[model samples]
Target: MSNPKIFVARLLGLDVFDPLGDRLGRLRDVVVVDRGLHQPPIATGLVIEVPGKKRVFVPMTRVTSMDSGQILTTGLINLRRFSRRGAEQTVAGDLFDRRMVLVDEEGRLEHEHESVLEDLAIERQRNGDWIVTEVYVREVTGRGAFGRARGQHRLVDWDRSRWARGTEPQGATSFVAAHEDLKPADLADMLHDMTDKRRVEVANELQDERLADVLQELPDDDQVQILSHLDIERAADVLEEMDPDDAADLLGELPDNQQELLLELMEPEDAEDVRRLLEYEEDTAGSVMTPVPVIMAPEATVAEAMATIRQTEISPARASLVIVARPPLETPTGRYLGVVHFQKLLRYPPPEPLGNLLDKDLEPVSDLAPVTHVTRELATYNLTCIPVVNEQQRVVGAVTVDDVLDHILPEDWRAMDPDQTPAPSTENPAPTAGGPASARGGAPAAPAAGPTTNRRT
Candidate 1:
């Protein structure tokens, strides 16, 4: 077998196959046994997420070929579930994203400067032991994009890095980068599977806007947990970035004092919107409606309304209808005139006024109306969103179908499905042909004669 040095990050999610070409599972993580201070940890095995999402361990020796998208393993396999043991850590779950100190070649600390672990390169030695050899890291230079630090990214010898003191919190710079392409909901699901400590660490590292988006998709309990762990000032900042209605919902779960403190710390404009929603009873139109819906004046052109809806920041539900109201286009406008469906705008000329296309027959719902009433109105009109009005008949906001569904669903609807597999065993089981014993107890057997090649992948 060739000895290619591969970054652990690149190995994650790669398909794992047996010698007979039978699909087995996907590579989830690399398990390594720490070899103390300056020595690279020996790569002991691979954590494979098999069918049913059950993660099992495949000792390194069992791996026959590892390339770009997949790994070929010898047929000899252990079906027992994989669990962490003394001195053993999984690269993806435990090491990547950790804060570490940079050290010089002489092992002298580099002014205590900090860096985050982004990836680890591992290679099989002549003796057939696979070990971590290089560390890819990003320097921590304070907050930058999305509140995460930005600085030089470098790959250094494994021995040049030292784990930060245990007292310090771990960093999530690399973790967030690795998953940056994931959708907010998918990211939320990923966060749900992590330990609370790691979840909070990642949340704190995320930018306010990004974290706010993720919070909106997470379960209410998760939202509160992540928020409670953030700094008060940052918590307020993140809340401001969230949709007003969602922010209010999250704040409602906190103690009055804590909620009030965060709200007070928020920008006045943002806080005012959230405070308005907080005043309404839960399950009411006003409580779930977004105050910052797309609103336009009676004289606004169809083209203008179309342009407004095209904005990327506006959600589909909010863009489905253009609220044509009296002067003062902002929420709580002069009066609730009517709404123009997006389809209607498409039929009219760009120069045509939105006022002429208003669906005057559609009655608006009162802010105080129950969610059931709002739902009936939306269903009867076949509308994605309906105008919400105050006692004075002024448009205050709009209740979207999504908001209705959120309220109607079970309280635990946002919770992730629990894994059906039993908890992984904590005890280290006996070693098999290519198990931990090679790294922990004694030298691994000699590798099968083959051309030796070492290249970073």
Candidate 2:
């Protein structure tokens, strides 16, 4: 039989019908299983979103014919909720519009080129089953001024790009490889133009830490939309991966019911930190500071401090400095001794205690410090993060410049396409606390303004 191609995008939300031509529901997602690398993943079934019922699964084995955006099936639509099993990948849910590299007829990757999937071409097999045959792609050239006009776009069968499924490298072989090398911020930027449904689909495919990083870079609306789509369990996991302040801010956007549910699902300690941040009124340092940080005790050696940072998976911004405190060390949190900027520690030998290297002059901010004051302090000191202390001068959390920008920028600033990389630390989860604080350079600034506290040394 001659191959008749159907784009997966055209099939999504199209009417699905029974053999008798009676309407059943709309095609919500296409399910497939990975057959290993460089092979086309097999179409196992279709998920139909019936109006009054949960999405139902119809096995492709029983699919009779597909034509003109309609799916005619001989199978009984299983009334039970459609559940994705292990090794199964969905087309609309997983691979639609994902970025992939196009290879030539000889299987060599194109030079300095990439394409966003426009659609998938499905063809019928001899066994009367359907499988993906070709990929429809649109090559995007350079953007025009004001980011308005991008160059000429044409759709083509870029290559015989077959789908290869695996958890570590899921979807097409090219995308699997390319996406692995992309930082979370880059990935977030790529998803900016995608529809919320498509964005959520991609979100579901990302690991918790990666999703958390991407969420931080997305607009608040998109953040809430994507998180709302995630199951409470997964949402909680992503929240745990996020900085406590960001997570708290996001949770504030959700309905109280959902917010509370996700909080309850989170680890008790992490949840409490978020809850505490939530208690602070918006625009306060306490409201924007991350309650969890790479904190060290006064007596910890440079070696021990670096060891603690290395052992913990913190993002670069969080790792920029290791806050040293008295007892009750927790972030957004304990007796504020002082801070040891990562750069200051690198200047000292390993056995030198952090207490000796502490930047004692870096006065801590009150929890209620005004946003303007927080901004000025950071800008004045060329700092990315500063400690937020309670009335007792105990360290509670640290306010990051990024969080400060999130609040002070215009409400719609989130809509801005990141022309540059999102922040100093693009690594997921949290950046490792190893590099010099100045390694991720910021704009040179004026002298520090706050009162220099007395140094014990």
Show how many residue pairs clash in every candidate, following the order shown.
1, 11
RMSD of each predicted structure: 23.0, 20.0
lDDT at 131 for candidate 2? 71
Give the whole-model CA lDDT for all candidates, comma-separated. Answer: 0.79, 0.69
- For each candidate in turn, the TM-score is 0.57, 0.56
Best by TM-score: 1
Q: Stretches of candidate 1 above 4 Å error?
A: 1-171, 416-457
Off by over 4 Å in 2: 1-178, 417-457
- Tens digits of per-residue lDDT, candidate 2, 95-163, equal 765666666677766544555555665666677666766666545465457643243334445244533
Least accurate stretch of 10 residues (summed lDDT) in model 2?
Answer: 442-451
Residue 201 in candidate 2, Cα distance off native in Å: 2.1
RMSD of 1: 23.0
